[model samples]
Target: TQGPHPVWEHGLNGRGQVVHVGDTGLDYDHCFFRDDSQPVVFYPQKNEKHRKVLSYQEMVEDDGTRDHTDPYSAHGTHVAGSVAGNSIGGNGVYNGMALEAKIFFTDLADHSQSLYLPPDFDYYFRPALEMGAGVSSNSWGSNDVTTYYVDTDRETDVFSYFNQEMLIVVASGNSGRRMGILSPGSSKNALATGSSGNNMMTRNDLSSFSGYGPSWDGRIKPEIVAPGQGIVSAQSDGRVNSNNCGTTSKSGTSMAAPLVAGACALIRQYFMDGWYPTGVPTPSHGFKPSAALVKGMAIHSGHPMQGRLGNRGGMLKGELPEDAQGWGLMRVDHVLRFADSPFNLHVENNVTLKHRERWHKCFHVDSGTLKVTLNWVDAVAAFGVRRTVVNDLHLTVDSGSAQWRGNRHTNDFETNNIIETVQVEGASGTYRVEVYAKHVPVVFPAGQPLALVLTGKGLREAACPQTCGHCVHGQCVHGQCVCNAAYHHVDCSLCDDDKLCHGHGKCHDEHLYKCTCDPHFVMDDCSQCEAGWYGPNCDSDCKCGDGHCDTVTGIC
Candidate 1:
């Protein structure tokens, strides 16, 4: 939310987006919860602009006790504010990341602000899914189990795998230790977050309280970090014992989680508005980026940190996405790529892969940082399992004679994790980044849906014919040649049959890419006239009169 007013002015502050929250409970009556300055209204009324929470419900546990039995959280209110609360309550100062976005709230807490997933965790998910929320922000987790893929973790991953389009954001707990991220945060598909100081861009100022992790199963935890220390957000009137609208300054990984979720709201909107591929939302190239794609974009956009805090957090691994900082801190602009001139960004978003199938992008890079990120929503692993990754996809980048494998040295690609990232100082040559399915136990026939994001300074997806053969005037998208209007076929090697010589002449060969015009007209398309007039070019003046005419003889 840095310089948020300008972000709103640019129309990138999460307009036309909705993020759901599963927490203690949201203060629906808070002024910041309302859009603009209008009064708040309860559920079922459908307040389009005046209110921000599109749906709200309290969870009823399997034991027949409601979550409202516990004291309501001023903390949940603060977290929701950080996600989508308006700045009106803060007098325009304490704005959420996606200020214009709406939200759905599901109370999942019974005892306190800390989260507790019941036996029927699906109950908390129904309200948001029914309301069509694309993202869910979870600020609580079970820190008791360490970073294992426990039942909660499996359930979280299973729901996302089944839903496909929904992304759940979780917070790394406050405990500061290696491999100490909480459950659900340890969920394979969750966008787990760490805590960074507010003033910094990188994790150089990473908070000491922020949780650190490389999950028990070897997946990097807290995929990104954001401003979590001393963050200010809207406070609930009832929780603070005041009826007047107010704001509160809080800290923890909880605060950090919502900031990332808010950023995702903007990222989701960028896609829905069809502004991502080429930044043109006019006709709307919009598509819902699968959870894998959006998660890849956010994690890929993060920047690494450097300092004592960085050294301590990162432990000088000489590579990115280590335990403490993960991929670094969130950079919203990098995801949007507003003008398209700065970074050479390319994405194969939501493409399916089969067993032993290889998907690759061949490009050339001059001298810059090259990063390849792969994310997939893996199938659920059963409870009490030593391994959690269900469908393993291997990532390798071949640059010249050197090749870099993702999570190098982990070697357990099959059971490693669902995300694999390869980053290197790219040389000046053809670079091929390949994602090969290693052990796709499930998703047969249909293929496993996944996303790959690539970016660098001078990276160019230059070679098309190498991957897609004979693609004349065509660009490859999603493993297929997107031929221009003039070309067609599997490789886009064929030209238009009806448009050959404008139907005025015969075609010698489609691959020749030339239309042999009739005696009447001449041009590439046979659209123009030669020195002498032909049949149609006669214009009812020449003596051809729909009859054959030879220019050499001038006879019909």
Candidate 2:
């Protein structure tokens, strides 16, 4: 129900992965920081004078100086706990997604207050990449009211676009339902996460305070949603609970971002362990998934949440809305299942397309829907540039005689992801998916790296029955012929019972019925005789007995 705990039960606890949390700071000595067998390593801030020590607990208290015991420190600790907190007192209820993952912290807040600056992105993201962190959890953002447009630090965009190895998951900000997302999260390449409340049921509802978006450029923000409301995680020593346990309840997009980051860590471990889809090729040692692939899997496998909570206006008809709820709530189980499926294909690689070059994948549709998603991190542009997508790729699906294109708005340069879904609707046949580079910048000598994930029931390798052709207007379901409305015969070839060949023929092939003639009769309808015929219906013989006579001419 909640993230297939079987993932950990199967020994995929992010054994060798690292997750970086950029916030105030973390409580390194908390029980959550220590696994059952050993202690989790902590990577302290590099340049900060206060955090240069071996442990955050060693920081000296000064005139209102922020330490590991401050309220702001609890925020980072809670976020870190959500990413990789181990169970305390042998209880598994509070265990994090990647319990065994090592954590690195960067205090983005200034010494005096919790105010964050844009330069923090460079300070933290660069080092995390250098340390080989697979995932980075960022819970802080600019003010929602004060910042309106897609005003993110240019350096952040450059880091995210260049470092395809590590995924940067940021909070979508608690800016209510209408205010949109905040900076850093507003960066087109980052995986911005929104808040959702666990309902203890099959689905989680969107949190009302979670920000919604159609970014200033119209690209979808908050690419995925996760459980964030009233989440329990580790608390600083100064804010310990009455039971003396260092844990507290907090809610916001801040809590949601780390959950996704931890999930990424688990997925990274899955790849690092040499486990890939059935037909996929496992890379050599030191090969990890690209950030675009991680982000694509999380978004593509998500469940859509448009009409569930009566927030069904706008573009919420069946398909996923571009601006709101993104590709829906993140389902870790689905992502794992997709990765393990033998039939589906997940391609995570870089391909360069020289002018008009196209990549095509041909597959057969058995009897259901086909879904394909193409995502890539675009290059960073100058501040205030109207177009964000430097390289453009288009997705198109051709099934049988019909063709469908992905959702492309008028402003195509603004969006970086393309999803194309085709419902066979009973008509099953072969399909071809084409991904072509529509445009490429002159400066990019090597093509961009694109993450492609193709899934659905149609991808399963099942052959249709040979008799499927008889069903003219309908599809073949489970080796049976499901005929269209106009036809009613067994093989769906004859129009009606009245059209039968006077009980002389039987409908057996894709075409009309064939007649079983007697020894003397010939022709498809059995109305003509073999040799010499005369009288009514050619039943009477020609009187030239013992003499050979022509079938058509009675000359003897």
Candidate 3:
């Protein structure tokens, strides 16, 4: 009856939350979501309206009123249905990942639409993030030639916000060109989803129209792949909609993005009690996974489906190509298992420790940021790091005792997704790094190498205990936990944007990328999409085309 339900059913749904689908709005009356009518927050600024929901059209001239309808764009409608559609009349053709998830439509189609590219896109993203949407799916992108970082004009380019607060998925562009992933989509922060197929047996091959990676900076692109080619989902108008609900032989990274978004919603639902090691506070609803945890779990656990043809790839060793299936196929089931596991991290008596020795967990430390040299036994190099990974070294410390107390001083090291290195310089003292991770699959546990290495500079010893703030458990003295140059304090935890500190401070772990909004700046994050533009993170414009948004201003 529930049609297999949302992949991650145990977590938050659109019920108590709102997920903004930035695209051409859906045909609201589509039976998929209409049968079990749910309230949708319609932001007309995007120029979208539901004929079945709205009585009159916006001030704009050409687009028809409530009664007159246009041919259903199977693309947008399918994406929406996968997210909030009610599967009642679904006929199994279209059942949303988060059927109960709320919908906020930012229609980029209309010129006079209140939420046009200018303001609506810019303002909408922050509002949604601040309000705490579970996730947002944008199955659109552009071929514009702009640096993927903070754009001056496009205010809606909030991919960084999505990465910071909630999980945001974007289509890796369907141009089939070499490394042609559109602007924001190509950005690293966002989880760019590619397309795969229905059958789960084959290896996930690179789609013809799907964009490929190695961003301009040479970072891996299109984090993961999903079913996109010839995908069959919901439809708006019935004529084009097959009686078997709505099936179409479509192709594009657009179709692929939603499947992952839906799957993520399901994982959030399944693993209701947040994973402990992630350090996410017990959600108001007890426990909910954070975007980082979700991303990490999904990427690490999902089945390896790469090195195949026509999308749906394989998962075994050496199955997919490095470029085609970056990591592997989207494994909905593995993520669920991670959610149900017992994992935790703690620092006691100047030692940091992590448990649940199954997943790849490490305590990262930076240079200068010295510390009571933390070392590990089983945590060996699981993944290799590059030079740019200067900030990516972890330590697995083991306190000789079991201290799980909720003390913010020792236990709380919140900065980025990884731990900040504490400057530890003192007489050579033995500190055991303890790690509780699955050395290898239960079946294959030997030679997998559980050896761990706590990376950092070997510093000169400190004279006394009280040298730097009584030698905080997770930090080093005289070798205190120092923030980066632009950063202030350990983990660079606070953003000066809120006017608390000056000169653009960095917020510790949670809000790492955001620059504190300086004085007189409109946005609190100090980041803004220059005037005449707007989008999720101020990355895009109202660039529209026949079926695409305008290139210049993001207008249709």
Candidate 4:
């Protein structure tokens, strides 16, 4: 289920999408890169002289010095293969999530250098955007020791906010139980990913080396986790003797990031391909989901794992711990299933919210839970600012009698998304969801863009009773009030008459009928115990300090 097989079976293979991978250069001649069935379009490198450039600045940077054919550095090739590699060369054993998706490579690491600085956001992100790439995969990050040297930038945030289309996926470094995440991965707009084990059923545990997180400002850093352990992918030149002819296995958050990036491609293609679930209504024109909506769907569909392993971090209060597993392990199947759920309603585009503005929706629910999530890529703050939430939106759910608020914790103030869940156990009523702008940034001229998803159980009609009498201490099952083992009556409203003693005991019958005997009485009917005995059926004598004693209390 973690791979692309399930998604491809639904006829979505990311056919028209382009994903950008930023790492060491790829081996262009690898058979996995060239498939007649679904050929991958490679981004023209600086060395390609005849390739057209978008601008003069891009043309000047095309110095042809970057060698994309380096076989020694197989990291970038492995990452790309895990993303969009085809089955033509690997005998269908090592196909990526998006087999038909195009690949765009950006050389961020040189094989000759041992230590290289992280690439600027403009170096790869801007290029991917210019080429109309909807998703970008980044498998590199700065080490924990170099945190002081890396400057947090607002470029990714600015691009995501203005563009509102492309998604950036970054690897949360393989630092294990470390407190903070890797550098560019900590960006507010990017989807920071941690590593899960390869086994999909047991993916709740994070990889031993996958980084843990709470960003510097205390927001959940790695928003999701994916399979990364011992992932088999294509190798450069087919000469590396690690595994089968042209494939090798690698483990790290680097391997996990591309899986998510490929998933993003499939999600983008699902909407772009005009594929809507059956019985669900669509507007006159096919709707396209925003990047924020996609991010929200991924995070909201995550399955929580923090409490299962007794690894509950102190900061975590609810079922999910933001610092440990973020939303939880990534489940693309759950995301797709949620999209097809009849009860769910997703916003197709971003909606602007002015100061003090509100949006509301009413839905009916019965005997289950109601969940609502509001997500947005907030405006980027200055590099060193402690607070990152630029536009604070509030989510509230009213069930007529009570109301629940998202972000209910008093101390948390930095996260950009809000999720609210209400329990409607055995209740039948209409619930109202309200989203309001609590704090809007003055810099946002038009207003903040937001995406909302409403999903959960729907209303269920009650089963009718046949006799039409009041049910007591029991519920109607198959048109009748089912009684407990100790009671026998039509509506389960009367005590068991057979268990009542002859003026010696009292019958109690709330949950079930039972008898409380008098001081000298014992037995099911309280008709066996005599003057000298007290126990049930007169099996034991009353023990007291004196010879003469009361039967039940054993008082002298």
Candidate 5:
């Protein structure tokens, strides 16, 4: 039977990834397999021929037989279901970190050997990342008599470089010693996990058997701890008497890593959805809780993990230990909140206004440049970045500064949007040039999008002296200002002579009336008389007057 409820379901059920379980072996036909297959999104090897795409359909034993011709190892099956088995019986106390995540499993556990290395461990992990799988869980460990600090023949860095995107979580061995930390788990990059129990009331100090760290390289081990002791999850064979095994109980740092792995998956899903229990942009990716923000938010927001554990170190007294518990217990809710909220800087100038009009919402940017000249009324001090010149419209705004001297630029403006000389930075790309209201300092593409809305009202309020009067901020631009030209009111308050029409022709304005040029004369404003007509209004019957004007013939 399964154990009590899992502590991490309060946040997110792993929703957006495929988790790879590198362990002894798993039975894919089990109920948990229903929700366990996630498509590969990243691939490490492209041109290489030896690389193979992994899947449950292709899982096999060393003998190449699909069935369990060998012994049935429930170790991997239990781990697999916890990391991603479908929540069939509701028997699952906690959903796998990547519940929707596909599982890429392999049996690397060799019982007879003291120190074993599966040939395809690196092969599977490397391609899994290239295919976009973000997390990998290793439940097995080895105890070599060799002294600490001894580097393995296969350098950890070699595979790590290719698997940078994958967060590999390994168990800190169950050897129950002062420092029994194992290989691969000893790697600097691996997030080594220790075990804790679900019964939080009685201070369940560190499990005596969970391996200790301060690896040969001197980095802390058991980076974090979770509910590993007496943990229960789906079994591979069948439920009870049937061949389709059901739930099983087990313990070790192995159980702890999957708890965090599932938490990581929840964190990814929360931020991407753009919501918060309190309606704030969910906070994410910050100074990992060495226990400040988590406690602070927990106390303020009914978060379940308040003053739960009593750690030994005085520094970790009201807090969780740094070396053993890492950042206290796994709090997925708080972790997801941190990942969703962030102060980010974004810049883009290449987007065409024509295409932007199609979007119901204005592009969200915390900071950066826009390729086209933006026209808006009173821009906000926090969101506005910079404004620029386009065509012949000399728009004006003083909210932010810019250094758009054709891409190769330096010198940032603290208060005003800098107007550097424009250049052809992008030959065939959409861009925006806007004047922001605040002079925020940040690098380009600074992670997340700021929670601000760019709308027509905001743009109109930050009106440009030159471009606004042409049409609405996002509307089409008509030709030159006919009324402004004829009336001599450069600002275009009225038509020429206050007569409504241009001296030589009709004025085009909000009204839409048309007037023909007077006899013998033709010019944009209808101001110039023909070559033969000389008198001021051309009414004195000069040589080129109306009736005497040459039409078809050259002479009058």
Candidate 6:
């Protein structure tokens, strides 16, 4: 689903996007960094793909120097190729995600002392953001610790909280499920990933080396799983030609993260191009989504795995936010393919909530199940503080007859994690979704911004909007005003441009709509996979990346 095949058909291949890579090294001269149409692996001295590697910095240097000719190791090159590689050299057999996204590299192999101590998270990421990179990928971490909330933990949260648009994807280290977690991977805001087998359909498919959560603070880390075992990608040999560059297979959570990074690039581009409401972008329809919104969409669309293990190591039939798999394997196709959902979906992209103020929204759903997900970039706690969750919040789903709190993992209410989800099944009724400031010791003056996603079958809007004394923003559907403002709520059932496009634009219809193929996908024929690479011609099922869908649900 994330291979940019059919996604390329929808006019999204990570054009006009840049993601930062924190790694040991990067081979900037690789031939796989170009488009799929290039048959020959030989690149010119000044190739257009040279621009693909935006900027490179050395994070390990103590005195701050650049070795322009320092050939990178195989890991960084593989990670980069997995993120934005094309199959030009591999006969379209090994394509990467987001084939057009630019890369910003930060080399962390200088053997600096700070690498052993607490990291200055802000120091590592801010420079990349200045280079116009909002998304980041980190596939390296310390494996010595079981579970610990170090300074890097709070720093990661601090950087994300302050830079709300940035989405950082971290590897959960190869510390195994029994081990606690790595430092910054356990950070509250970063999207920590675990290792999943090629097809994560059963418990047997989960990786034995993948790290599980129940973090030091007792919150679930490794929020999602992806394929990382026996994955093949471009290998580095300090050459930009196909004859010199080779392919290698590696297994670790490190391999799983770049896939998520590339998938996020496509997902990010989906919203950036204004393809959400319709196939085009108008004034009201398209705008940048917060990092929390992207993270929530990934979680809400995830297909919950079966045979999850309990705390005592016994098997549990079905579990929400399982320790081993978090919210199950990522099913990004379910989110991008808006028409196939079996439930109604609503989104509040950028909701800024103040301290001590409660945000409430009421909706109606069927008797089957209701899933509400809340994700935010929380304000960071002080360093050396055992309690890393500084500004705590809780989500409660109320039906007047019964109530369900969000992610009651270990605490009475969730107090350690920045992401919370409450899924409940009950008789049909009007349900209220509340985001309460359970405790906010440290508060941002502008208020903490969060994203909310609700999905359920037979879903529609109930009452309770205090704007214009009624609903004037969105059109009424199914005998109720379902489509509210995007910041307020977005209904999935509404297909009209007027109702759906009003998300970012609020009721302004003056802007014209046009779809130009300037910087969208790579070329005219978007399929990068060759005729017999993985399937016949590219119409058939060919996976350039390593994720396999669930057998029952068909989600990846």
Per-model TM-score, in order, reads: 0.76, 0.71, 0.53, 0.70, 0.48, 0.73
Model 4: weakest 10-residue lDDT segment is 50-59
Per residue, candidate 6 scores C-alpha lDDT tens digits across 1-556 of 2233556666677888888887756655556654333321111122234547666674434465543222434577788778877654453466667787877777665432123222477778887677767689888776567345576777788789879887999889886766656867888888988876664354335576788777877778788877787778777665443334567788888998888888888878878777765444444666788899888877776667664342345453347677778877776765664444456667788887765557878888876788889988877776555666767677877665456778744224676677889887663767878786644533367777789988777667798433222223565453233444331222122122223331111122233231111111112222233222332212234333576633223334
- Please give the CA lDDT of all the candidate structures: 0.72, 0.63, 0.44, 0.63, 0.42, 0.66
lDDT for model 1 comes to: 0.72
Best by lDDT: 1
Candidate with better TM-score, 1 vs 5: 1
Evaluation by lDDT, superior candidate among 2 and 3: 2
lDDT of 5 at 132: 53
- Pairs that clash in candidate 4: none
Of the two candidates 3 and 5, the one with more favorable TM-score, higher being better, is: 3
Error (Å) of candidate 5 at residue 118 is: 3.2
TM-score leaderboard ranking: 1, 6, 2, 4, 3, 5
Candidate 4 accuracy as lDDT = 0.63
lDDT of 3 at 228: 75
Task: Report the poorest 10 consecutive residues by lDDT, candidate 5.
Answer: 449-458
Higher-lDDT candidate of 2 and 5: 2
Could you give candidate 1's per-residue lDDT for residues 315-426 as a string of tens digits? 4342466777788878877656555446677788878887656687688777667888888988777666677877878887765446677766332332476777877774
Candidate 2 lDDT by residue in tens digits, 1-556? 1454756765678767778877766655566764334332334433222211122311223355544433534687788888988755433567677888777666655444364544445655776776668898889887744242344545666887777788889998887556788877877788889887765642356776778676766667778888888888877663423223367789999998998899989878776766665423354533578887777777766776654432333333335644657777887665564344423544545555643356765666555556666777777776556646567677655553455555533222223543332333453566656566655555777876677766655364344333333345566765344666544422343332223333223333444445655446666655556777743334457768888766555666
| lDDT of the structure predicted as candidate 6 | 0.66
- Please provide, for model 3 over 358-382, each residue's C-alpha lDDT reduced to its tens digit, 9 standing for 90 to 100: 2222233323321221211111111
Q: Between prediction 1 and prediction 3, which has the larger lDDT?
A: 1
Using lDDT as the yardstick, the better of models 4 and 5 is 4
